[model samples]
Target chain A: MQKKSRGGIFVISAPSGAGKTTICKKILSRNANIKQSVSFTTRKPRKGEKNGEDYYFVAQKTFQQMISRNEFIEWAEVHGNFYGTSRKKFEGLVSSGFDVILDIDTQGARQIRNSFSEGVFIFILPPSIKVLRERLQDRKSNTKKDMQRRLKRAAVEIKDYNMYDYVIVNDILGDSVKKLEAIITARRMSSDRVDPKWIKDNFLR
Target chain B: MQKKSRGGIFVISAPSGAGKTTICKKILSRNANIKQSVSFTTRKPRKGEKNGEDYYFVAQKTFQQMISRNEFIEWAEVHGNFYGTSRKKFEGLVSSGFDVILDIDTQGARQIRNSFSEGVFIFILPPSIKVLRERLQDRKSNTKKDMQRRLKRAAVEIKDYNMYDYVIVNDILGDSVKKLEAIITARRMSSDRVDPKWIKDNFLR
Candidate 1:
């Protein structure tokens, strides 16, 4: 009998402005197996941001109500804003045989891992802390103080690299994408996912 | 720190005349990541068989001595002829980060899996039992009874296809090679081999 397709959740965590969003966009556009998870955030929508597409923007009271109802797979507050993933949405995507990709903070990532022990956790890294500082400064969006704060926080974050399933350095965009794609492709054919019946029926006795 | 390269072993098993060896040859020539694991056998060298390159030919007494010493990874007798894999050679290739491909029988494949639980196993099947019988009959190298015996043996072997990581139906040679390549390529990126350190240091805080 043919086995049914099984889907997994791919949790990709990266420091701010490390190109995780862009890479995820490219992969989702190319890969048929992946579905990106849109998060719900209790923050005012910025100009050009579409609700339910960019994020499910809600008021603080509304987000707290959802939290009280335990509707989220995982949630956390950052910079006075609440961000969370809906458990129902995540389950719907996986049950349909599409691996869901979650772009979230490390705390959220860990929570998801605790809930789904087999979730594929991938961490993205900059080539170096110095390069990261330069990239953040180059963006012209953050103040010098803001850049310094991020770099300092990044040092602490880098220590958790060992907790992930795959670590990719953003030394080059194209190469990093190749490495990520390779990881996803290989994980799909893992021994746990293989059907032993296929082997027993084909190999000579 | 620089991450280690990820590699994997792919064991391909098929009955005689199923074209596994030919497909393996094409696959190795195409994939730079794969290297063939040449087996050691005590069978008398048929005409045109080259020593070391084809099979490591050894005397029956020497083969038995090696078996007693536990020098071979797996050994089995077929038609009073002995075949086995050299453990040292296989280990050396694997430690060097080259994915080794084993073209062997089901028994040998099972032994390899037991010894190397991490290896990816694939089984190849003919399109139908009728096609398998016709292919064996056309070989002309075996007697009619021998051909019938092999055909009967193949049917029993087909029952074990469920034991493999992947199965290829060898109706077309080109498509079969592509399928094998995809499986191997995917196997190399599994989380067990690929390092995740870079991801933690760069991405999550």
Candidate 2:
């Protein structure tokens, strides 16, 4: 028998303005084997966001109903907007042999890990606070107070870095993308995913 | 504080005449950060085998002395030839921030794993018996009995492939090398190797 392709759930977490979205975009565009998990959000789509493409947009009541139905793998609220990952979709993508990259928050990630403990968690960190401040400035808010508040929150969230399987420092974009790719590739070949019985039946026999 | 460099012990095992030596030579030549763990043997050096370079040729008396002193991390006898790897050399290379790769047999690999559970073990497999047969024909010994014996031993060794952290099918040389490189790169960023306090002290602060 030929070797079977194995897929894994990649849980990628990062603080705000940590350049995770850009890295994820580059990885998804280059490798057809990998795909980003399209999350469901109660908030309206932004100007350029597409429904089902960017997110599965739904009403707050609908999201609550799904949650009650236990449809979500994990869900959390951000700024009063509910966001979640659909369990059915996640399992479907993985079983189809696609590496599913979930760009989710730590809170949601914790919930996912409780249910899907096999997922590989990666944490992205900014090179320095100075660079983080500059990146945050490029966003909608540019005030010093806003930057400080965000930085403080980032420091708090950084404690969970230990929970990740890998950590990438976003100093250079190309290097960070390469690191992410390596982590995914390595995990795909991890012995935990390889069954000795299958090896014996196929190759050894 | 800057991110610290990490070094690990990579234990690589392969069956006889599986093209492991060539792949290992390529990896060593390309990656300067990776160093091979030279083994000491009681067998006399062949035409071009250099002392300490090819195999650390030693007398039987000296080998036994070292073994009795507990200087060797792992040792085994193959075809009446005593061979061993030094604990001192392995420790020195890793502590110096170099990834130490031990190209040893399954017997030696099992010993190392018992002593150093942190090491990453990788097993290389041939794509097919036809390819392996062709590769074996190119080697110095090509008698029918020898070939059968080697192939039988190879099948037995193939069962240990699951003991490795990763398995690379050596169908295409370039692709296998790339996969090995990715495994090493990803392992460098593994959370078990990264110091959490260092991250908190440097990045978070």
Q: What lDDT score is found at residue A41 in candidate 2? A: 99
Query: Candidate 2: misplaced stretches above 4 Å?
Result: A1-6, A141-149, A195-198, A201-203, B1-6, B203-205
User: Where is model 1 more than 4 Å wrong at Cα?
Assistant: A43-49, A191-205, B1-8, B14-19, B44-49, B78-80, B114-205
* CAPRI-style class, candidate 2: medium
| Per-candidate interface DockQ score | 0.23, 0.65
What is candidate 2's lDDT per residue for B141-167, written digit by digit as tens? 479888887888888788887778888
Summarize candidate 1's per-residue lDDT along B87-154 as a digit string, tens digits: 88877777777888887778888898888888888888777666777788787778988887787667
For each candidate, how many residue pairs have backbone atoms clashing (under 3 Å)? 31, 0
- Supply the DockQ value of model 2: 0.65
Per-residue lDDT tens digits for candidate 2, residues A141-202, read 45778777778778877888888888888989999999999988887777667666666755
Whole-model lDDT, model 2? 0.85
Residues A55-114, candidate 1: write the lDDT tens digits. 999888889999999999999876568999998888888888888899987879889889
In terms of lDDT, model 1 sits at 0.76
